[model samples]
Target chain A: MSIRYPNGKKFEKKRIFSGQKNVNNKDDRFSNRGMSLEEDINETNDYYRAHQIAVIHKKPTPLQIVKVNYPKRSAAVVTEAYFKKPSTTDYNGVFQGKYIDFEAKETRNKTSFPLKNFHEHQIQHMKEVMQHNGIAFALLKFSLLDEVYLLEAHELMSFYDKQDTNRKSIPKKEIEERGHLIPFGYHPRIDYLKIIDKMIDRC
Target chain B: MSIRYPNGKKFEKKRIFSGQKNVNNKDDRFSNRGMSLEEDINETNDYYRAHQIAVIHKKPTPLQIVKVNYPKRSAAVVTEAYFKKPSTTDYNGVFQGKYIDFEAKETRNKTSFPLKNFHEHQIQHMKEVMQHNGIAFALLKFSLLDEVYLLEAHELMSFYDKQDTNRKSIPKKEIEERGHLIPFGYHPRIDYLKIIDKMIDRC
Candidate 1:
């Protein structure tokens, strides 16, 4: 599936060409693909914030900053820091009086999105958001196909809970059947709020 | 004019010892003495967010990242960056359906809070907020007396506008007479919502 921006500009998937012959190219993973999913989501978030369409932002990675160096006549630099476990989803904010929360991920696999893409902490975070009556979802981008799908957290949780005995990955067809396809746009890029409106209407 | 925490803990005011001369002392003008005003306000905001009382946060300083190093197997590290000119106040969020925006500052001067403590961009930002029907204000702390006040942006603008011919600072006595004193509390620490409640009531 191909995605088109608001002005009819088509977004093509980026490919990596390497000279190394012995490199394992058959194994597909997000990190190995070189295109950062976080960066793209952040860009889309900035577009949303600038247009006042939404106020979502990625929470700063929690850090336990232990020591700082106060160099002579300069800004203090953090010298020693460690990452701390995050208690919430990566992105959250208010949009039109509704609390919105979501996590974004990309996968290079052509057939399925792996259940391992999410963590236990993130699952728990989404559960808490659901308990609080907040809208929670995940943006899954099939990088190779240039398609983005907004999958509700409830749907994801159902798949996650059966991961131990069932298939370790969710088929792409399942997502297409159950998830909302988010179209890219000019002003807000990923206009997820359109999907949000539908979800609220259904509720 | 002295203030104490809700638990009755006295805030310690930093003092310059007589005859202690050092180059670092010259740099103290820009540096926070101790328990930074920004840090304290952030803590207060944390309290607000956790309790669902409000959703305020300091905007991350916009940075023009110049150089980034991409290691073979590590996350990208920003090596050099500089702050961009911000077009809005440092802090903003929603409080009970009202958009709230504010800047925070601390002064050691006993008689007055210097107008120079504020930046031109901050003033412009507050003006824009007012134009959008947003509540704008400044949280000023007098470090010498451990007192904090919520001074409305309009009151600050009036003082700032007269600074060309009048004194360059707002007298402490005037602030005491006009500004809303923020009471500290065990849960919220700054308890700024009391002043916000009064503002909403007036509206």
Candidate 2:
């Protein structure tokens, strides 16, 4: 059983914990105690749901089960399973009657965000989302610098599609220029929808 | 590990195979070579994607992985896992810039559709979807009668919320009166989108 992602990264069930990022704090709406990027986004989504802001969720990791034990008088147990490559991005939902789709990734590299973090199908799926007039983007976090940016699908594609000439990764400088810096806050740790609101208003 | 889902149903990996549903037939669009409701919807989704008509997909089953092994010079293998209850419906995507969400269920009952097949979270999720102006529905298949209907989320909730006053299951006559009959055809075996088109037109 191959529990490797298409990007060749080992699949570990998300196991991050932040002792400081108190999710139950309703009093503090703009304080960021710090958390992993995925944790921040998940917290933000829960906030969104609680406040009826929008409906977004992270899709579960795809898996291929090869064997199972259906013992009598008890619950079934998965004996052997393998991770499978996902055909679409991680997060999707609706806000203001528009369909939103995006993928989130983080890197410790200080200079560039590697294109290899994204798989071929993810990019292709984003393109298809855009073709259908859905809002598509990538939430990139430069963990070493504590910087996060919302880059539209087209901008990422521009770098990816010109791979013959471009570097294997997107330079931090280019991301800073083309992407919108996502601000952190107290309640919804990563306030991404604010950027979306601006994008819609500007358009 | 409890592999029994919240609905108390035994969880097993999808293991259905149909010898007749020719998914690759481009020339013979609309041929209803019989298939399971889930299979028909999946094939329809694939066809819609190939034609650039829509971008719907069934979400992967959620699982609670407990243990994984990382062997040297090879891939990781998930050795122990349990099925986790899902928070949302099975299928969702963007179609004509509209956010569409739905669950497909099949029952052998000829006279009624049981409400137990649905969970509280799914109903709550659909309500949230509708609140945000997204499309929400259920693709119900009465296997014994080969009758399928697209029942909007609100309608399902009406009976669900009035559990004390109403029968546990929705009568077939009530469904026929209230739900939109989903027509099966050659290309996309179940043509629910056509009903959506009519819904938009009438509105």
Candidate 3:
């Protein structure tokens, strides 16, 4: 399961730890101890898939490979490649006969979530998703606060635009007021579909 | 850009040449001279995107890297990686508020498409997509015959299942009769969405 780099260095799984000191220590049914936000979302996706509730999946990281080595009677080996920025959001799939797409990110900052975390291409992609009548949103996890919120793409886009003239980050209060709080659950740790249900109801 | 393999050999694009010798020579608006089926489909997807029709994209080839070299003032380079079989279909995205997922393959056989072109994991993935109420199908292109068909996942799954005891190939006659013929157009070369529209109408 462990991967090594060309330089003989092992690949490190980047973990964004929370800044809070007094977070709950008890592991809830939904909690997997020491799991990162990305790991939690992946587990939730698997849960949804196993139950036949949805078919969402995180797109594989894009890579631009320049050179490869094909040994006779063996698998091809990539010798040179660089990571590429994704053109769309992380997660997308079908739920209740609807097109669902969203990006999930975690921030350790307690006061505000930095807008710089998202790229312009990703923002443009969400806008396109919304224009096509597909449900688009962001799963913003305030790791320090132990809180997750589902913010609509429109809200995120608006804040992103304001960064050019106004504040560069989305204040915690704005997110709390505008975003739908997603309650963690046992089987599906981050029950995002629950928030999606409400959004669908409103529509 | 050209790529080189580890054995000092240049990577060549695998093309399935047509089996028939009497194919048409006239340049049709739908036809992009010397382009492979994959290239044409990519162009069609781009056409769809420009027209606000859909946002489908082919997932990048999955690679499991074991080595990389990170140097200062440059992006990290992957030194050793192996290809992995994808767990889902190639092209997937939202189309007209519906979740769309599909696999596209080109064949050189004049009689029937060899079932060996598809893998069991792919069949299972399509079944999962169907279970989630997503639109799942296969774009089968007979390169020699210069014909393309939009075959439903159910049709493919049934034929795939029969391969265990029945014929290993799906006869061309069976495919033509059961699958919808996708008309080629100037802008969006393979207009498979027309077939999807008919399918939706039937539903």
Q: TM-score for the second chain in candidate 3?
A: 0.83
Cα lDDT, all candidates: 0.67, 0.79, 0.78
Candidate 3 C-alpha lDDT tens digits along A66-185: 777769999778888888888988788889878899988777677899787787898989998998889999999876567889999999988998786467889999999999888777
Error of 3 at B109 (Å): 0.5
* Pairs of colliding residues, candidate 1: none
Show where candidate 3 strays beyond 4 Å: A1-33, B1-33
Task: For model 2, state the Cα shift of residue B140 in Å.
Answer: 0.3
Candidate 3 iRMS, in Å? Answer: 3.4
**Residue A188 Cα positional deviation in candidate 2, in Å, after optimal superposition:** 0.8
- lDDT assessment of candidate 1: 0.67
In terms of TM-score, the best-performing candidate is: 3
Per-residue alpha-carbon lDDT of candidate 3 for residues B79-107, written as tens digits (9 for 90 to 100): 88878878888888888888889998767
Chain B TM-score, all predictions listed: 0.80, 0.82, 0.83
lDDT of 2 by residue, A52-147 (tens): 989999888777877778689986788888778889998999887788899988766779887878889999999999999889999988765788
Worst 10 residues of 2 chain B by lDDT: B12-21
lDDT of 2 by residue, B80-167 (tens): 8877778999899998878899998766567988787787898899999999988999988876567789998889888888776357
DockQ of each: 0.09, 0.48, 0.48
Q: What are the RMSDs of all candidates, in order?
A: 10.6, 8.9, 7.5
